[model samples]
Target: MAPSDPVVDPISSRLDYDVGELRRAELAADPVAQLRRWLDDAGRAEVPEPNAMAVATVDADGRPRVRNVLLRNLDEAGLVFYSNRLSAKGQAIDANPVASALFSWLGLQRQARVDADVEVIDGDLADTYWANRPQGSQIASAASPQGEVVADRAELEALVERYERDAEGLDIPRPEHWVGYRLVPHTFEFWQGRRARLHDRFRYRLTGGSWEIDRLAP
Candidate 1:
């Protein structure tokens, strides 16, 4: 019998809508402030996992990888998250030192995209965040070998048991391989959905250590 030809899927059609009817009064001056407002609103709405975002990183060879990670922290300096330094995402960031973050708050019909340069945070900062984690999470961090393939689930379970027994009545030290990183934003774009698809797009770019905001075509 002849082998069947490989099947390919076609891209979906793009949706069209008027993007000019959205309100821009709040986004006229500073995009960062507007982002903060939206984030606070998202929290007030009790959106499930409001801090969850898709983080994209590139490898040394320019291959891109994306995954969902909890937004551990955020500020004007940048956004922060923790991971095992030896993990795939960590290694990719180490090699490329560039990343992008996307936040989609569908309930609010808002999205935010951030393109940034990444750097591993200092040991002291990582330690401070580690100290704030729940005891169980700290224990799990010590036990699990993130991004490393194991024999099976049983193997991981065994490791967890051993670590738990050893950590009984004691503090689990943060592993050297586990730490936090920050992405310093070079550019940010804010999108707001509107009636009749007339959305609002505002972009802020860093130029000469200052931010310049501009309206973007939706």
Candidate 2:
């Protein structure tokens, strides 16, 4: 917004947690394997939405934006997340395919960040994921223009209802714009909280055909 824009109510927020120290020997040599271990820990600890992550991308004008997306797939290939290709984020990815993703598991006193070049996943993969989506979500995907603003809530609701009714006896096809992006990260950073201000951090960089791990000063 411009400097002349009106302001809303001012507010502040903060939180502190009692977290355990992270040891260098506790991490896996392979960053992807380490990430998987941490994710499993998040699930075992019952941390809400263990697969939710923040995806960061740049707009056409060079402004950066971030949004929370479910981590659909992960492997040596990269991290995958699905979205409407026509949405603001998808459009941004089209214009600028490089992106970053972050997973913050505070309950586990851990966080992971990946920075990489991004691109749409194969059509077969997107098709499989779309077919497995819940029916209600498929309807919403069909009805919603994603980033487009609507004049009224009723209009959107009615559109969804129409799509649902039309697909009563048929499968809800994925919108043409609905697809996935894979982040082929060259760098991965994992952080673990500790007592006092001394936290532990490690970075894994893709070098040659293997990974090079380095400890970061906390």
Candidate 3:
């Protein structure tokens, strides 16, 4: 093919979402509650890794980074996920102390957004969760120096093997750098896709000590 050869456009592959309407009457007074309901729906629909979400953070340099992480815990307080304290996400959270998380359940034609303040949960909580993780995962988390460059896959595997040997006949402890952080949400948005590109969107904002809900143009 020539350098100037035209590339095929994949515009023909598109979807028309016709999910059910998101009515105000069906929404929970609390955004967290409403989000929980949607999460349940996602699980019931058999969406793979329903708890997975995309988290976005800004670094000290004012640049943004986004990555997918599993939602380890959720409640009225906020959403929680675990990571290495020295990882890029951790460093960004350290610098900005705020983040936005997005949960997309495309099969259900729905998405939920969370904008919140970040806070490190207590070490005890982190330890408990760590203890519950599979032995392999615990060893891998301990072995990985996340966001740091390695020579190659071979080096990473070697490190994992070393950790595996060390963890033999012992409970692998959570590394000091591995911990959980909670996002205490100040605002939330739930979007439901509809036919013809028009969608239903709602925003919930924390005002004073209560939450206020409003419909957003989509």
Candidate topping lDDT: 3
How close to the true structure is residue 105 of candidate 2, measured as C-alpha lDDT? Answer: 95
TM-score of model 2 vs. true structure: 0.90
Give lDDT tens digits, candidate 3, residues 1-218: 54874466587666888868899999999998898999999999999999999999999999999999999999988999999999999999999999999999998999999999999999999999999999889988999889899999999999999988877899887889999999999999999999888999999999999999999989
How high is the lDDT of residue 74 in model 1? 80
Model 1 worst lDDT window (10 residues): 13-22
Candidate 3 matches the true fold with a TM-score of 0.95
Pairs clashing in candidate 1?
18-197, 18-198, 19-198, 19-199
Question: Which is better, 1 or 2, measured by lDDT?
Answer: 2
Q: Against the true structure, what is every candidate's RMSD?
A: 4.2, 4.6, 1.9
- lDDT (CA) per prediction: 0.84, 0.88, 0.94
Model 2: residue 110 alpha-carbon error in angstroms? 1.4
Task: Give the TM-score ranking, best first.
Answer: 3, 2, 1
Candidate 1 per-residue lDDT over residues 1-218, each given as its tens digit: 99785475355444454333336565646556766777887899898888888999998888899998888888778889999888899899889899999988877778899999998899999998898899988988889889789999999999989999988998778899998889889899998777656688888899998888888876
Assess the local accuracy of residue 13 in candidate 2 as a C-alpha lDDT between 0 and 100: 38
Cα RMSD, model 1: 4.2
